[model samples]
Target: MTWTDDDPGQGEPPAILGLAKLRTARAQEIRRAQDTLTTASGDAGVGWQAQSQTAFAAEVQKTAGDVELLAVGMEKQAAVLTQYAGQLSQLKDRQRILEQRRASAKSSLARANAMMPGGLFSEPTPAPFVLAGEEDSTAEAKAEEEARQRAAAESKIAAAQADLRAIESEWDALVADRRRVDQSCSTALEAADILGAVSSFSGSAVSAASPGDLLDRLSVLSAIDLQVLLAAHPELAEKLQAASTQDVATWWNALDAEHQQTFIVGLPNIIGSLNGVSALGRVAANRINAANRLEAIERTLADWKRQAAQPGSFTNATSQISALEDEIKYLRGAVSEPPTVQLYLYDKDADRIIEMIGTPSPETKRVVTYTPGTLANLDGFYSGDTQSIADWLHKRDEDGMVAFVVKDGRYPQNPLTEANDQQYARGIAQNLADFEEVAFTDPLLEGRQSVAIGHSWGVANITVSEALGAHYDKVVSLSGAGAPADWTPSPTTEYRDFSYDDILQFAQDIRVGEHGAVWSGRNPREVGFAHEDYYDAPLTWKSFPGNGLVNPLLAAAGGIESHNLAASTAPGNLTLLNDMRDFINEAGAPR
Candidate 1:
């Protein structure tokens, strides 16, 4: 049931290629719809067209243009994914070939070893003094042949093993490249603001007016008609779905106590996922959402398993079922966690999620929110290191601080991907901004200390969020790349950047955003950042506490690497822990 893409022949072929084809099909469908709209607009004439009719025709043309733009974006996305899938297919093929060679070499080595030193042709050897002509010529010949066979086997084995290692290295490179291409393609679509664009074009309606107007339109419909319309346009059914957080919060507050309770129960998905909504209300809403989603995924998983068991059926159904199982595991894991852990937001399909470690109440004095860099996914939400880190941060200030770990959709999984792209950070920044409004706008918590921590790519996300109006009193960067080169932070936001002898800084320019923001391609300790400070020398100890007689130079050289120091400094007495303790005191927050 392990759906691994890293091992060739172990799982299904790359599903990414299939996804690209699906997008292409959707684009074709949208293109056809756009053609129909354009043709209908052309068929209508000014002779019978009243003022309202003309306006309606113009709106139709506008919607057609929007649909056309969406179709183009999807086509572009499909093309990029297709190219990426081709590259992955090549890598997979190369891996399989090398594995076959390794297997053959191993078999050859085994056969060579089975040839005994004195096989079939064995005889007593004559001493030097004895008659040399009487020596066993057959034995000598057999020994020579056996020696050659052994040497040849060793040579072949070495070559095969080396080739296999090379393939593994290529696999790592592919993972990195996949992230770069994925981020670039996704950034373009996100910049176009094509959220649910395909759905909007594929018969789902989007209202041009306010939520109230949408409700008014729906209120008069018969029960049967309402059900059909709502099925097609669920976005319209939840009035709060399209509104800004501020507006939703205001509207929710204006409702009487009884009505607010009714809305929380009626539309838990919308109420729970909204920022600026009450903390407890969201927890209640999100719990219901998670339960419902988990139940549905379980049902689908059972069906997939049943299909997979049938003879001659696509065994690849196992991969699909395994993915659903992961989602279910993550969903149900919340029940086992501490009661304080809040399911702030969970959109499994979109791959965006937020989790809070504790209650964000008036008594809360400090808040620490962590945004991960790369190599993270929603599938591992509950069982990942994020919860461990959250617990660590929470323990730092048990009474006052609330810690949040956010995975704001998909992130570029490679450090070489160069996540300084504003596009990559923009969505995360918006989420952080909304989280701040929702978490800290209360009486005492509003004035409390807010700290934002970023490790690796998260550093860029935090800074971009700051630029986008996510206010934080302190920011800590752990081996993270900086934001845009020319971008400046407000004087109110204190920045603390930490970097060990990290080598990722050297590969920053390999794949960068259009803005071309890079990591300066030099050691942070030497060149230092053009914008932020590098404080590794003072915080990181040259020699640890108990290094009694060890060579000072050797001990210094044995220091931790950049990624480890950035990840967690809790154990092994690494250099980063000292800084973390200082930060816990300095920022008056932890986690």
Candidate 2:
């Protein structure tokens, strides 16, 4: 694009105050559009007689509002440009003055140099800076005489060089204000842009109908129209989250597969996190999201490097750099390694991940998702041995069992401090419930038996999720914790919970004892289960409720060990490990 001195509307804003006159003209043009919208919105406030009168008026008002916002955004952008131009003018003026000071310093430094034996005070341009102590072969004086000759000259040269450095510093600071202005303005303009800068700029408005309403409207709308709406409001599809999973699944499944992939490609981050998307679709979409995250990291890393060019920046930002690098390594490994795993859900905002060990298809007979306990994080999953549990289960799939690892979530990080906290479980239950319903509702796996498996606090997560209406054929808890105060399981769903009767088992008292369950504490043993058993299978059951000798010492180590999983293939008590594997195998497939 080429711009004459005629107008800013012709091209980009130039970096001078005179050019801001052009930007002001552009702002005036935008204000005219805003004035038109303001008038239209006023007219829409009146009564009109027709069935669609309300709808038409609403459209006018919305369109008008959007145009007004666009005008505002453009005006704000122009205002910033003008402000920046003024700042630039002032900085340039100051920079010119600083240059004069620097020249004087350099001339004075040359005079100081002349006081030394070899230097000439009369040089027009200062000689290239040289150290003060260099022996001037022309000096044939005694020690005291030479010291007296050099002392005042050395001080003058030092002062001149120091002044030169300070002037240069001032010049750098003065110019850098331009970047500061640009950054601040860009940030503010971005916020205004969110008021539909790209979409509303043309003053086009779509339906104000909700997500479920859009489902109906979508049927009659063209694909291009859908794109326009989605482009403008990515949340149009995302709002389906509040609708029924079955409804969402049905609506989504009705779209052409190509359309589905296209939507995923267009907004992978938002689509990947939505329920009712097919696991396959979510996996593909979430992978894109992960790549996008890594790309974002790369941009941030580049920005850091640019900043690092300045002294002291590296020291201040080293930790941030390390974090970025680690995330890169983790994300790269996640996208590529452990070929068995597929990215199902990668919600960067929530810091959550759900990885599938094997693809679920129409023929798949069974599916299982494992939710981890406290202190589980992205680093633990991608960098540590967390995938092994799902990998181990997937390995034994002779027929058709797909395994998933809820490798990371917003679970509490500090076990010791959070051992008593049950709010995390309650908080994530509905989301977990929604996740299962949507992720597994596809035709490919509709008939497959499903298992909800969890360990430690994760058990409480699944249990509360079940209470919230997540359907599962079976529930398995490994060293489970308490659900919410009034938790109850569905009578139809079978439940099996295991605990080592260890110190961790006793830790449940903090939650269950401190807070009461409807009848018993959140202890899985107390909660009704069709078939609940301990891994060790002690000689005496005692139903575990009667008065009897309870040995905390015996179960202490094993109990703590049981809270965390040591995959079937990992080194542990052979008998207990073997039993656990057998149990997982049983829980994983159709009975």
Candidate 3:
């Protein structure tokens, strides 16, 4: 039976039973044809005529075999259809039972209304007319009993209505399932017919047909169905794996919007991880995933709140509840008011991409991705640090548009001890490379200058990403902790920043002397990279142009806060910003 939204009867058992009968008849016809072919072969003459007859019989047998296969496929399709129909029938029966129960409830409620002195509309009959000398207490007790009965009747009615609603919802779901199953069966039947026809062909026609066409046909299927098809055909999965990024994007975009949304919802892990899919598409899917995660966290927080009053559990619950709430708050803000091309490469299991800002587009002339280190997260990225850098770059170069990104590379809890670990930088570097590849594919961004800037341990991340094959025109290691001893800069131009008064630098120098290497083991200055000593750079009170005393005091303070102040836009650190601007301009300038 062909199922459609408007045709309830088509998905019923009777229609499916009829389909089964038709399939059985078709199978019988195929058997009859086989018998007829055998009889015709028997009627052929002997000797020279027998040889011709034998060849004819062989061709007939092959055709009969094709028909038999088709019949078998049809029978299987019929069985599946019957099974789905039976499921629908059972659901309908359950719905009928629910309706019956609801009707019974209504009848009971009516009877109670009629007998409880209410007459369906009036108040309780005056407590059954208290007789002369009858105790008033007895009459009051009767009235209370009548009120209780009325309440019980109302409760029964409400419960029945709720049950009916649930049944209706289930019935709707059943109908949807029936429709999907019917579509799948129909597709199988069509395929069987085509295969049967192809098998009947002689020579190389069958062998010449490529499975690519069949795989392409599945592109029109629902995401869930496609997944089922792939699971059944590992070869198809291999084909998909071999597809190019552009090919993947094209295939993904060809699906209807509804199916695309379904894929995003049903298989986010798959869609989000595919490198060939457009970043915009991945972002769309990832945002949904993030929202789902937030919902789950909120649900857990609610559970925790329910158990918060237990003895000795209040403090722990409160702390966990606060953390969950904060996470939800951050997620909501990140997903809200997203850019036109918001890409979410976040992995909830790893809590990656704490924040990624701005959109990558073809029109972008320059892309600058910043990695923050040590306790840096969504909160830190949104707290002016990311925007200040973007603003500085934009102010420096007004002729070109820049896409500024703030990537939180899952920094370790202890920056001092963990900054040297190469493991932490590995994943971030790979992700950076992938992001660059996907983001720069647009023709408009061809040959555009791309830069990776890391602050503190972030520099180590940038260095590792470069070592891992992230191609950028320039790399900025601002106040870097260190990198691997074997690591080499990958960018065409590499710039290193070290503030002399920076306490981290002093610690790093001492650590290098003790360990014979910086945290990463290789200091950028020791290598063939340009260096900027922000500590020695002159400081000026731009806000207070004539305050001589204020400038020196501010400069002294800048030295003490040099580690962070160098990256800051404070008046005392104006020289540091100027130096950064010059470095970027020179590096980004046409060669």
Candidate 4:
């Protein structure tokens, strides 16, 4: 393989050089063809590799496009689900309102039925008559007829009561259904983030994450959601703020169980445009506004219900507001100015009347006190002569200074509602406090009598009656309540000396032979106390109609009937000393 640089390979022959030249020329041609072939092969391999790579890239891009389309479809479906859920929730709310109305009607119907007559009696049987008077068959026949009449009445009462009970049961079932629907709506609202605020700038990331991931990221949505909620449902939002730690824990627990899986599996791709500009914000705002307006309208409708129940309220309001200017002479029928009642404050400290009616009572005596439950207003005093048993014994004597300790306490016409009960309770409590403040400031009432008389639910005022330490004397309830179900004692009984029969009987005894004191005249029913036994048992049988006497005015007063009776018995301003003294002694005395 060693070759000389020069010298013609050491000895070149002319003929041989010619032969080698030919051979070399042929080899050079062969080598050129091989090089050309190699280059062509290399170029073809490079082109094939590039084409394969292009095809692979197309396949990857197609796969990505399919995935994006699937994500879009999922998002659309989620939106539709949200909309349908909202619609269902609204429907449920409407159903609840309808059910509430039905329930109210049913309750009224049941109450009416319970009040019907005969249901209050026990089954009638033949009676034993006196031997001397029973000799005649005619007398026995008359007795049999009376018994038949009584039985008929009893049957009618029973039928009415049964109907009422059936209606009430149906009403109860409907109420239960209403509650279920309300709960379902609440659940749906929670999932839809009804109260949650959507931020235009940074919307929920839940839309983007899988359902599981969304649950993990819900905390991220909490702050904005809360803001949105406050703007949407102010009342509910306020409640949310006041919710206890336990409530929040419960809410979170329930929420986690309900939507955790859905959020995680479908959130991310679903959250494509997670900004406020999206449908979530708009839908949330619209739904919240609708709900709020619906609630407000419902409240308005409830107000109308009161008007419907008592046409008198509407009538009074109309007359008062219109000043009776549009009424014809006949319609205005002998209109007379109602005397204005004034609350006089007798300052025990100054020994003078400090303020007149429309003013706070004067804090005088050693125990300054204001007694309610009677015709409270000195001006608007009740003139009727149906006196409470207390009044018969307690009103002033013949001598002006020797008058009994009786005072006319005004009670305006006011209906009893849940809201009314709460308001009245608060008013009475505050008024009691006011009395204490006066006592402290004045020297006269230092050791005087401090007492408050609440007639009906006004008995609730007893809750704050003893604000004056031991200064209070006696709290007498005329016709007080028993327990609603009678499984236990009356709720307000522990707070006062409860009595109905005693007061009624006492009232009867005091007016036995007095002038303007006839039992029939004193009772709105015009039935003498001697005959009350015949009514009491039947009236007490169930809960409605002839069983319970009806006096619209008394119902409005909502206090013990005796207090109003006292005011009615007294013709003018008179002392209630006799009544108060008697009641104090006989608070628990036997009938």
Which model scores highest in lDDT?
A: 2
User: Across residues 252-272, which tens digit of lDDT does each residue of candidate 1 receive?
Assistant: 555555555545555566667
Worst 10-residue stretch by lDDT in candidate 2?
A: 3-12
Question: CA RMSD for every model?
Answer: 24.7, 18.9, 21.7, 41.6
Largest TM-score belongs to which candidate? 2
Candidate 1, pairs of clashing residues: 393-591
Of the two candidates 2 and 4, the one with more favorable lDDT, higher being better, is 2
Which ten contiguous residues of candidate 3 have the minimum total lDDT? 198-207
State TM-scores per candidate: 0.53, 0.57, 0.52, 0.24
Provide the clashing-pair count of each candidate structure: 1, 1, 2, 63
Q: Which is superior by TM-score, 2 or 3?
A: 2
Instruction: Tell how far residue 366 is off in model 3, in angstroms.
Output: 0.8
Error of 3 at 113 (Å): 75
How should the candidates be ordered by TM-score, best one leading? 2, 1, 3, 4
Cα lDDT tens digits for candidate 4, 396-473: 222111101223122324422331233434444454444443333222223334443444333333333332221244
